[model samples]
Target chain A: MPTSLAPVSIDELKAIAKRIRAHIVEMVYEAQSGHPGGSLSAVELGVALYWNHLRVDPANPDDPDRDRFILSKGHATPFYYAVLAERGYFSTELLKGFRKLGSPLQGHPSMKALPGVEMSGGSLGQGLSFAIGHALAGRLEGREFRCWVMLGDGELNEGQVWEAAMAVPHFGLGERVIALVDRNGIQNDGFADQIMRTNPPAMFAGFGWKVIECDGHDMAAVDAALAEAERPDERPRVVVAHTVKGKGVSFMENNPGFHGKAPTREQVELALTEIAEGLA
Target chain B: MTQAASAAATREAYPYALIELVEQGVDVVAIDADLSVSTMGYQFGEKYPERWYTVGVAEQNMVGIAAGLAACGKTAFIASFAVFLPGRCFDQLRTSVAQPRGGLNVKCVASHGGITVGEDGMSAQAIEDLALATSLVPFDVVVPADFESAKQAIVAVGKTTRPAYVRTGRPKVPAVYGPDYRFELGKATVLRTGTDVTLVACGVMVRAALEAAELLAGEGVSARVLDMATVKPVDRESVIAAARETGAVVTAEEHQTTGGLGTAVARVLAETVPVPMSFVGVDRYGTSGKWDELLTYFDLTPARVAAAAREAISRKR
Candidate 1:
């Protein structure tokens, strides 16, 4: 059985997250067509998982018993590819090829194209079901690898997400699967609450999942929540990570305009400077 | 000319074939919606309860789950109504199963194809399933003609490692092929030979095309029959040969004319032979009725197919 890595100290994880955010900004700026707001918001969550929680080896990516991670909010490819690259699944140099025509880092995550990506995703509401697929397969094979899936708050509006929510508990896969909702509260057009109000914690709890809430940007809180999720229970677990749309850069933070827009070169420099200053 | 005395429903053979695969040591898992009893997935579940999954009425989730299972090195065979498998889960099929192309062996065997669904009406019948399944590039689409063929197709799909959509019917059509029939993917079976016209068909319509060939023979017109079981990656060699040998062609299926066998055959002929062709298929939505009445009402009968063949042969230049 694959084991999780030694927990990185909170400060070290925060620094790693800063570098990851820098990569996210640079990649999106280079591509000129990628989602940065959600990617930025998901920085700590991604860093914490790949660096500390997930039982994956950069050297042996295809290890059958390694923990699986799926980016259900697929538009956040900038964040996901950055985390994988930072963790040495591939070179961080490939981050520049994000969303390029021939790059393996497609605009959306594709499992066939990339070695580390667990499932192909772009259309919303499909990832949780796919996570359940991995969990179910693990249960049947008597494998100990855990499956983690991350979803955007607005993506919960898609009917298929609820369908999967209802199914996971019915199959009693609470212990094997852990879902994280990036509660950035923003979507493509506007605020998710304005578009379609979905009280996620209540919604998931109603569907019979054990719901946990935490500050998504706080490295320690997010780490603790993930740790709690792995504790065995009869119901599937979901961590409703409350986060800002863009956490590092002041201009883009809490701004829906940056949801699907790439950062300008100047904006990238500014975001990097802000992230660097925070590290200082 | 005598048809088989007792017909066997293709749905009836699904469970038996699945069980055979499981017993043969194939790492096969069956997933079904709430329609297991109707789709005949219950028998497989009853026998191998550990490998079967009943996902209630959610067809979209069923396909996604199947993709996940396939991702984990399990050959997942998912079954549902033909209308819901590709109809309800086309997007999931495209991204999760087809686009990844990781050798995800998710075989979707959809039952209740076409108006043969009988008395359940338009909502239950899936006339455009072939079109929908074929539109997803690189998907193997097969509509087997009878019980023997359905069983063989299922076992063949289990041995192969590609995503496939096998459309079966609710009605028990006459056995066109015997138990000794060998099923091959992407190859159309030539059932009869003639020079006047070629009658090409698939699904339940293959039996109609054979009976039509007999009807044409009675009228001094020689008609050939080709059972085009695989709709996608269609046997181009056989279709072109049929058009060239018999200067005209008639395509029949219990589906809409727009994207079914007729459209597939026409595309091939237009590219290769360019023969005069007539289509016999349902041009509109189906309604509640007996299977035979619906076939006649949709002009999907031996008489209509024979008429189309004669008309096509006359238009041959």
Candidate 2:
């Protein structure tokens, strides 16, 4: 069982987000293969969940009663792995092993390989269903622990995501499962709007989810959206955290090219400097 | 020789197995993809309404939800047509269930396996399910030959911790085993003993193999009949023994010759004792016809098996 830590201040969380962003830039740069833009965009959301909201113990990750978090948008693994490491699930030093051979931290999150990883993911549109599974299982076991899953805006293009979207509410797990869509508009090819247009808020609402919108990078807003998810409702809740694709680094910000490509070593140095200065 | 009074469909035994599992105080959950009636999931659903979930034509979600339920400590049994469950939702099975390495206890009970699905034709028949399922490293594949074995397989999955894929047929085939029959995972049951050739079969074709062995006995050819129900982690000991003892092998199934029981046996024989072998299965897609007619059309009959067995024997060194 994880002992509850004292509540972390929003400012402290913001500082932590900056550090997570720096780590993300460095890890992706060292591997020379990863998605940095989406990882940077999800920094604050991951920070908020791991630092303050999620009820999990790094030591006892398999605790049946612990809250579950699944990175359904698995390409943004730098954000997910950084948060787990920062939360003390594993060594922060292992971040350098991202996508390397024999590393537990693969390009995608693998539940079997990593301890804190609640589910293995890489293929999009599959995470929500996994979260629904955990939520339903929790309900069956009469456990109060909630399940939180994150989805990429472009990943919603998968028909399976909507299949899970329809199932969550039909199963009446509104109160138990909370979904977050990193509403970063860029995809691998180009802008999500240019490739495929999906109005997430309206679509989730249409699928019977209680929809909430927040500025993903804003610490307070992200926290508030997650707090609102705590309320027990008959319908599942979805937080559409609108954010920039490349949030911290000026060069990568809103850039589709950074969606999957890693930054050069010099670019990493500049991005680190920009993230460090952003804390000021 | 006497046969049982009536044939039993392994599909019919599925519901009763679920009822028994629930009565045994097993913490089981059943999930279906709108094919609950055809898959017989309604039997468990009616008895344990709270534990049953109908995912409504979404086989992918059905499999994913079942993986989740299994992850959270419920023994989840997911049911759909054999083709759709393993064929459509294979990724979920690979990543969420099998790859997790005992993280989830999900039983994939796929009904209507192989060309025996009858008039529904090639589209509905899961002739290659065994091959698809066996490809997954951690999944245990079982094609129960009769109602008793199907019931036992379900109960075994409930008690075990690993992920399993149990294939059941739509048609009612003759009962191959009695109530006293025990199902050991990854082990083959040798129904008859012989010396000249071996006939290995699974699912509906187990009966055909037995009849083929009898037909071979009339021609002074001693044929061995081994029912290899578990296809994934195949019973190597039995398969090797049959190969070494018989010198020739004939594998039969109500599936494609490439990836089902035939391939499983061939793999074992190729790696261990190389032998002259023939396969009695559908090498091509089946057409719309009566179940028995389709079997004949595919050359999956006792006559075919007997002929294959003779050919295999003649080719022996």
Candidate 3:
């Protein structure tokens, strides 16, 4: 049994990632309207952060010193909800109610609707700025809480994201904030390069952020990168996690059609079976 | 009416009021989009450097950051030109600020609210801000009538947990409220009372409504002047009562004829009393000129308000 203070091993983290992917497919299949591709792409990143680094207590979620995790790419709520539940923030029973009326499980993460959500997010590119706010407030109050925000590679197209990228270093809040970018390489319309070539590592470096490139699916590499990110630095860090769009499922890999489309009954069975086999 | 002794821009009182909030032991954080000087946010920044943030001309980022700060249990106040606030970052306000049920104590105080932002051309003016702000769910919109009211309005919103939008103007205007006057969030102040016509006005137009009431008095037309400081959740009881008593109504504002104070008052009147009404506001885009000159050019004047009152009263029979 992994205690709260005990570190989760890389193999256990990988097993947890597979379960998260399975939950994503099942939840999206239940909702019949959710973004599965981005959610699947970010499963490993969520697992690594929640299982290893975040100093959060599910019983006392409103702890002022607890590290905040913002889903900047808000459409990936299934990934966020799964990880949060697995961490004991809420019961996994809520997963079936994703995007349903009067459910805490909204299509996008609503901070007010759930106990552990750090931001009420849906419209893209605003989450990083909000993370900066959390960091700034923590700095002023002399709190050591860190802010970890996850961003979609496709969401880098928004001008507001760049604005936040520029302001974090100027405020000297670089060390207090960590941005995780899931480089899925596919947006809603087509390939991310065709929509906008945001070479994130180069772009974030230009904005004076410390950039780290890692293979997202590899649990050990992601854990190592996150650990390295916690090292004292004068600049904000961006971990560009290179990931397949529809990770863990064969047919949906790098497929743009699965970006926001619901999987058919047969596809759901196949995807869940594939995710379950990954755990085996 | 309070003595119009000296004139001061409503924007001048904003920063001082922000400082007062901190002095009162509120955890206040202020952010500006590189318009601290123009928006008068520099005074607060000067006093509280630790809690001040300048986002360097990025209005969208300023709003998003303000939401984040508010989420962390701070009363985050964001300021910019009225155009840039609801103008440039409407989506940020809708999603990040207004949509949050909890952790949404963001006070978006926009300076240069209307066509009074003259000499800077149409781009700087925010004639539709009140409309845009009032459209959002649970946003308490306050358009202060003068310097005293502006300060009091800021302090009122600073002390509350609800998300609010308070608008201030660039040009200096005569003081309408005294130092002792208290500003309620969703209530209107009756500046003058009469029986024939009720003139409802907001922001700088409250003074115009008062002046119109005086003019109407001269022509044997008794006009009731209502200072509708809060544009959203507009003083419905006052509006309904005035419509029922006066039988005629005229709405005045330094905003567009559509979806402003006029629209707010009209909704109340149509629902309850259904009085004859006329709207006195700008229907065309503003042109470059002096601040007061633009008010006259856009027909947002005392004479125009008085004329609108006569039209509504004439149609009452």
Which candidate leads the pack in lDDT?
3
- Give the residue spans of candidate 3 off by over 4 A: A1-5, B1-5
Top model by DockQ, which number? 3
Give the C-alpha miss distance for residue A123 in model 2, angstroms: 1.1
TM-scores for all candidates: the values are 0.98, 0.97, 0.97
Would you list the clashing residue pairs of candidate 2?
A174-A235, A174-A236
Of candidate 1 chain A, the 10-residue stretch with the lowest lDDT total is: A1-10
What are the chain B TM-scores of all models? 0.97, 0.96, 0.97
lDDT string, candidate 2, A65-152, tens digits = 9988988998899998998898899999999999999999999888758888878788788888988888888887788888898999
lDDT tens digits by residue: candidate 3, B1-317: 35545789999999889988899998999999899999989888888888788889899999898998898899999999999889899999999998887439999999998999999999888888988999888788999988989998999999999899999999888888776788898999988998999999998899989999999999999999999999988999999989989999999888888988899999987888998999988777878999988988888889999998999998987
Q: Predictions ranked by TM-score, top down?
A: 1, 3, 2
TM-score of candidate 3's chain B against its reference? 0.97
Global CA lDDT computed for model 2:
0.88
Task: Rank candidates, DockQ, best first.
Answer: 3, 1, 2
lDDT scores of the candidates, listed in order: 0.89, 0.88, 0.89
Q: What is the DockQ score of candidate 2, to 2 decimals? A: 0.73
Name the DockQ score for candidate 3: 0.83
